[model samples]
Target: MIQIGIVGVGTVGASVARILEENQDIITARAGKEIRVRKGVVRNLSRARDVAIPLTDDVDEILDDPDIDIVVELMGGVEEPYHVVKKALEKGKAVVTANKALLAYHRYELQDVAGDLPFEFEASVAGGIPIIKALREGLSANHIESIKGIINGTANYILTKMMTEGVDFGPVLKEAQALGYAEADPTFDIGGFDAAHKLLILASIAYGIDAKPEDILIEGIEQVTQEDIAFAKEFGYTIKLLGIAKKVGEFVELRVHPALVPQREMIAKVDGVMNGISVIGDKVGETMYYGPGAGGDATASAVISDIIAIARGGKSSPMLGFKRPLESGLQLLERDAIVSRYYLRLVVEDKPGVLAKVSQVMGEQKISIETMLQRPGEGETATLLLSTHRCEERAMQQALHALFGLESVKERPVMFRIER
Candidate 1:
């Protein structure tokens, strides 16, 4: 029998306890051993919990108990959890965590400390999608080319509601908070940091690259507007905040931002508080993983999966899927060096030669316009939406600068990447 100690009995922790107890026989059969939740550590013992497990206020009890074979850190913060996980590993305990922010910054350090120890964190990336296992084991033979994903459920839910109901962001965000889809302070989710954290984890595993959340280009969905949504509909595209990581000739590019995906793609069809990741590899062509991105039960399912692996005495594979060190001395590709199609919405003065001036600026930057739309101005300002052929991102930045300088262009243009 494997005895487990769970620290932080919150929603996910409670779900883990419940699932283990409810499915004890099946889990035992699959794991080849009976796993027991020996103790649970929490800040407040007085807080009512649904699970019937024994609880303790002292985390040390779990850490010091020699019988506890696995320590599950469901704690959400950085410094403290880092210390706890470090201690757990020092005691030779296998650890599992769902804290993406902590892992995004400290993965390499943790992996170094956990040398040859069974440390698993399948729940850190996409709730219950098994993406980590898929990349680490199932597709181990292929060289991963690129990954693009809709990894943040709150942003996805908000965007989906906005697209379907023509609702503004503020009301929808409030509703999401009320329904627990978003937090009281949703900056982490809405500002794209949550997705960036998850993306960094995936990038590290796929490329053996240690990337911090700050090192990547992260743009939130706060700037997505009804006009942009309308334009996407007209162009037969859906706007989603995507976490994109790609390897290009010794350089890896990582970014999380709003993207215009063609309606025909399966990833674009994933809607409403769900997650989807599309991975293109050398041999597999293109493969996608999709499921509930977040929730107590879903996340708990992943945590339990990791626990089962440990209970079954599975050896730790290379956390990043590759055993050899990734080629060193290679820099992460600058965002400006990336090349892709773009969706641009410009508020311009409704007069002759405005379109010509915009086109001229794009031409100067060597950017080709693919599709164009002009809406009648209510007053002196008109809306011009243009989709461009594939071009270097630096060229688009320069074009935006030139367009902003033009007297005919009213406001700063809204730009989003177009994914086919």
Candidate 2:
């Protein structure tokens, strides 16, 4: 019998405790042992959670207990959990976690701490999808080329509603909150930080590149307007908040932002809160993994899979999937050096010279406009939606700066990159 201690008993943790009892026979059969949750640690002791496991308010109860073989840290945050996980590793307990932010920062340190012990975090990246295993084991033979994913459900839900219902971002966001899809403060998910953290976890497994959320270019879906959606529909494109990691020569480009994906692409069609990841490998081509990216059951299922993998007990691989540095020696690509086609939106005064002025500024940066769209706005203003050919991030910023300086230009320009 394997005894596990859950340190959080919140949504995902509560579900973890429930599923262990509900599916005990099959779980035991598959794991080759009787897996049980001996205790759950939550901050609040009074709040009732529907689980058979014993609950406690103190983390030390689980962490200090010698009976607990697996320590499941579902606790959120960085520093505190970092210490707890480290102590668990030091105490010679196997660990499983769903905290992306924790891994985004302290993965290497924890890997060193867990030298010979089993430490699994399949739940950290893509919720229920076994993306960690795929990148670590199944696709281990191939050289990973790129990873493009819609990993955050809140932002994806908002974007999908904006595209399908013709509603604006505000209304859709409110609706998502009411439906419990978004938090009261949705910045973490909508602002792309959540996806960025998840992206870093995947990036580590694939490229062995150590990066944090602050190191990459992350943009939110908050800037997307109905006008942008209309333009995408007109051009057979769909807007998705994408976490992108691509190999460019010796550098690995890691970024999270709203991307204008072609409508025909499989990833663009992944709508309505579903998460989809498209991974391109040199030997086996592209593979798509799609499923519910969040929710109690989905995330808990992933947690249990890690637990089961631990139960099966075998030699553990290096946490980031590499025992040594990659032979190619790929470093993180600089944010300004990123090159991609872009869609730009400008609300300008309804006049003839506005287009000419914008074109001149773009030309100065050597950015050629491939498509131009003009839509009537309130009163004497017009919205100019333009798509540009591939250009470096530096040049695009320069053009934007110059265009904003033009007296004819009103409001900051909104830009989204195209991923085809």
Candidate 3:
């Protein structure tokens, strides 16, 4: 029998325990043993829980227990969970986690600490999608070319509502919160930090590259307006907040931002709260994994899969991780060095020289406009929307800065990278 200890019996932890008890017969058969939740740790003891397992307030009860064979750290936070998981590894306990923020910062260090130990985190990236295993093992033989995903359900939900209903970001965000799709603060999800954390985890498995959220370009969907959605539809594009990881020569490009993807692309079709990841492998070409990004049951399904793997003694995780991507000496691509087409929106005074000034700024930066649209705004103001030819991010940003300084320009121009 495999004894499991849950360090945080929150939403996912409770689901893990409930599922284990509810599906014991099949779980035991698949795991080759009886896998049960022995105990759970929670911050509050007065709160009632639905699981049948014994609950405790102190994490040490589970950590110090001798009979526990696996330690499931569902605790959310960076440093605290890191310390707990490190100690769990030190005590010779196998670890499975769903915390992407923790892995984004300390994955390399944890890899060093859990040497030869069975450490699994399939639930960290995209809930029950199993993209992590697909990258670390199934596609290990091939060199990973690129990974594009709509990993954060909250952000995807907001963007989908904005496009389908033509609603503003604020109203859609409020509806998402009321529906339990977003948090009260919503900064982490709407700001793209949530997706950024997940992308870093995938990048480590796919490219063997170690980078934190600070190293990559992360832009939120909060700045995206209803007009932006209209522009996307008019230009045969769909706006989606995408977590992109690509191998460009010797450098690995990792970024999370709102992208204007052509409507025809499969990734653009992934809408609502569903998460979808499209991985391009040298041998497998393009493969897509889609499922509920986050729900208690969906995420618990992934956590239990790791436990079953541990029970069956199938160690295929960090065991080959960072090493599976065989491509070596790859460095993180600088944010400014990225190259892509861009969509820009600016509100300026309806004057003759306004277009000339904008064109002259683009000309100076060596950026050529591909398509342009103009709409009258409040009073003498006009909204100028344009898409540019492929250009380096350095040049495109310079042009935006110059345009913002123009007397005719009213507000800062919004930019969204266009993906073909």
Error of 3 at 50 (Å): 1.7
- Assess each prediction's global lDDT (C-alpha) against the native: 0.91, 0.94, 0.92
Write one digit per residue (lDDT tens) for candidate 3, span 357-392: 999999999999999999889999999999999999
Q: What ordering of candidates by TM-score runs from best to worst?
A: 2, 3, 1
Position 169, candidate 1: lDDT: 90
List the pairs of residues colliding in candidate 2: none
**Which consecutive 10 residues in model 3 have the weakest lDDT in total?**
319-328
Q: How far is candidate 1 from the true structure (C-alpha RMSD, Å)?
A: 1.6
As for candidate 1, its clashing pairs are none
Better of 1 and 3 by TM-score: 3
Checking candidate 3 for backbone clashes, the offending pairs are none
Top lDDT model: 2
**What is the lDDT for 22 in model 2?**
92
**TM-score of candidate 3 relative to the true fold:** 0.98
